[model samples]
Target: MNKKSCLNCGHTISDEFCPHCGQKSDTARITVHSLIKNDILGSIWHVEAKFLHTLKNIVFRPGKTGMDYIAGKRIRYNNFISLLLVLFGFNVLSYHYYEKFAPAQPLTDDVIYVKDFFSKYSKIILFVIIPMLAINAYSLFRRIKLNIAEHFIIGTVSLLGILILFLLSDIVSLIGLWKPVEKIFNIIDKIIFGLSILFPAITYWTAFKNSYSKPGLLWRVSVLYVLMGIETLIITAVLYEIF
Candidate 1:
């Protein structure tokens, strides 16, 4: 059989990975190990190695990720929407399994779930349009020439930041510090709120850095970041709690 050519580049290699483009090589072999390694595990992840790598770095280095993304280092990271879908899907599956094993006590209070749902979901539904619109408005306000799509992309990246933190917060919860875990999450929630505002604000700054003359905008930027972040968190919590 003729060897498969690199989809990324014209180079060819005989293994499962391309030496030149680093793209995974697809073959006709059908083995159980290959199926597990390639189909189940690699399908979601290996499809975008660079993206996973970038995601790792971004998770560790909070503000710097967006900066790097906007600075044209995107090849190393999954596209904003793609990454969100993957991470969000992982969260959903995780919570589902967790709930399956350790179900939330049936709500004794009739208003509890409802109130929590609204408290979280309402903002998400409202902000479904706000972040994008806000970005467009801010872009126009600053006279920076970009598209609404850019706003969407920036909004997505900002949202991912929140998800990463939330996931980290979840990991922290398993350390057997339930009370402290709750407090830490509360604090992180506030911090995330701050960061959300900071997110778009920085995204704006980065997007419009060429035109904006402000030198030290981090403080004001942080305010917006936090507020918007809270909104994002509300939405995330709603979705998570529901499913």
Candidate 2:
């Protein structure tokens, strides 16, 4: 085989990849086959691997995952912002379909308007809300000494977990069994809502405990829950006023 120059940096190379710039040496002419196989399919698989790895860590070891990512061990996980965007897409799609296909309940104009507004602006709302939560977290846990950006990363992971629960709740609500038994459906809805809130609290507590080596686990967890509640209330009030 002839030694070829690196297309990226013009360095001479004999191996399959450029040592200087790390670009693949086999940069052949582009074709439809190569585009589909290497670019589209390969990228999908790579993203899927990173996403699932990050999700597993977020689900089982959220604090350690957040700490690792903040500490610069990020090759194994998807970026926090990327994950948040994916979650937002999933949330919007799931809720939109749920509202469209599920049996309609008679809602007042104000209630319908609020729901529509939230559905349209959920991502914008989250963009604002997550930073506020991050600020509260940083303030409450200043003893740990992490900066606001690190806290924001932690907040994003916590929100990702909540988004998963929210998707699950939407799935459960779409089940056909709910139509016949109004009482049962309402009860299940309340339960799912409660679990959505509780799971995120647990997620945040675990992540905080792992990320920060603080002494007061119980106290920290309690205070964190309080902060979350306050944040939720404030967000709800703001949304209500806006819509």
Candidate 3:
């Protein structure tokens, strides 16, 4: 029955929260006690829970999650960059362990080379790979009616799913440090690596299977592979020139 402006967005409020921005209607001045109780205790838990929820959604149902985000169900989810940063941190830690605890027999030179290359250029490679794959998917899947930006989200989510599979494979490979388990882990690693290779195509097919007739979908996926190959070549050439 009383009118007040929301401190966050300066929107007029009549109830407990400002509907415009969802900030609490009764804004209070920051104090040490409030900071500890409300922000440190409350906000941290809220943020942590939200991040886990978002990660679960992204990992379990990337396509549906992407669609829901674009459709405005965004309050509970972190954006692509936030989750990517978390993944990047995970990669950094994994690489550190892989280096500090070197495998007993040492990996092949090709594997070492691949690891070094990605370690040095992962940030740059990520910027290129995610967007390029997104563009390719957007181009082929335009029938879904998502704008380029929306498709960008879908593309990145799909790629993020692929990244998770590879990261798990790499983590699994780490167990190979134990010689007795090394051979078995290596076999498991190869299987996971094989799955990672096909994950993108398989995920795309599954997402679009009902969106288009089988032949139509297959043709689009085929072109997507060609475009992805060309994109990879272009990125490699550019990165080679630079570093």
Candidate 4:
């Protein structure tokens, strides 16, 4: 390997990462631009950057991306959890702004309450359920050679895909929040609703398929699909009973 000096502790190094201080050998020098751009403003999150590059792969070839990641071919991709948390922060900010423009309505019935609850908090709920979802997936696909943490990686990526869909739908909703296209936005919202549910299962299916192509992969994924449906209904039922 080519040699370099560790910037933090002045140790000699021969790899991208320093073995002594564990810092990147090429850590950017601190400047006002670097400080705000790289760290806070996320200037590196552009489409041509590693984050969007990873997203492009995740959108098109999710399963293969997950497989390659777990197989240790991950030098090019950004951290999945970090990317998700960043996006979730955007999600929260967008909703908070949109909520300011909308009016409050009293919860008249259980159906309305559940629908409103999910309308505001579905992505957050889905994020909370990811660990449980990972457990469900691993239990169903026990034949695959993955531990819970590895299963969590797959689940996180799948949820990332769904979160993107939700944000897109919410953007449409936000536009309709002020515009006069109430009817059209209603249709679009319905479409977004369908896509949000379907895309996650599709993401999980493709990811699992690409990672391992064994017999019964189809049925295992199908079982997971059915379980997710049951889980959603159970949640709705529980919410109905509680509120």
Please name the candidate that would achieve the greatest lDDT relative to the true structure. Answer: 3
How does candidate 1 fare on TM-score? 0.53
lDDT of 1: 0.59
lDDT of 3 by residue, 1-243 (tens): 989888889888999989998888767998999899888999998999988887777667766777788899898887776787787777678767876787456689988876677678877876676677678888788888777788677767766666676677768767887788999998998887787676667767766677999999889888987897888888877776676
Ranked by TM-score, top first = 3, 2, 4, 1
Candidate 1 Cα errors over 4 Å, as ranges: 1-48, 60-73, 97-111, 115-143, 177-243
Q: Any runs in candidate 4 off by more than 4 Å, and if so which? A: 1-7, 14-19, 22-48, 102-112, 115-124, 177-189, 210-215, 235-243
Q: After superposition, how far is residue 188 of candidate 3 from its true place, in Å?
A: 4.1
Q: TM-scores of all models?
A: 0.53, 0.75, 0.79, 0.71
**How accurate locally is residue 112 in candidate 3, as Cα lDDT from 0 to 100?**
81
Q: Could you give candidate 1's per-residue lDDT for residues 1-243 as a string of tens digits?
A: 467687668787778888997877775567999888878888777666776676676555534565566567776677776677676666555544544554367666766866666555643553474464456445454454445654555566656765665555444443323565667656765675566444445545555455656754444455555655676676667686674
Error at 7, model 4, angstroms:
4.3
Against the true structure, candidate 2 has what lDDT? Answer: 0.77
Error of 3 at 6 (Å): 4.3
**How high is the CA lDDT of each candidate model?**
0.59, 0.77, 0.77, 0.75
Ranking by lDDT: 3, 2, 4, 1
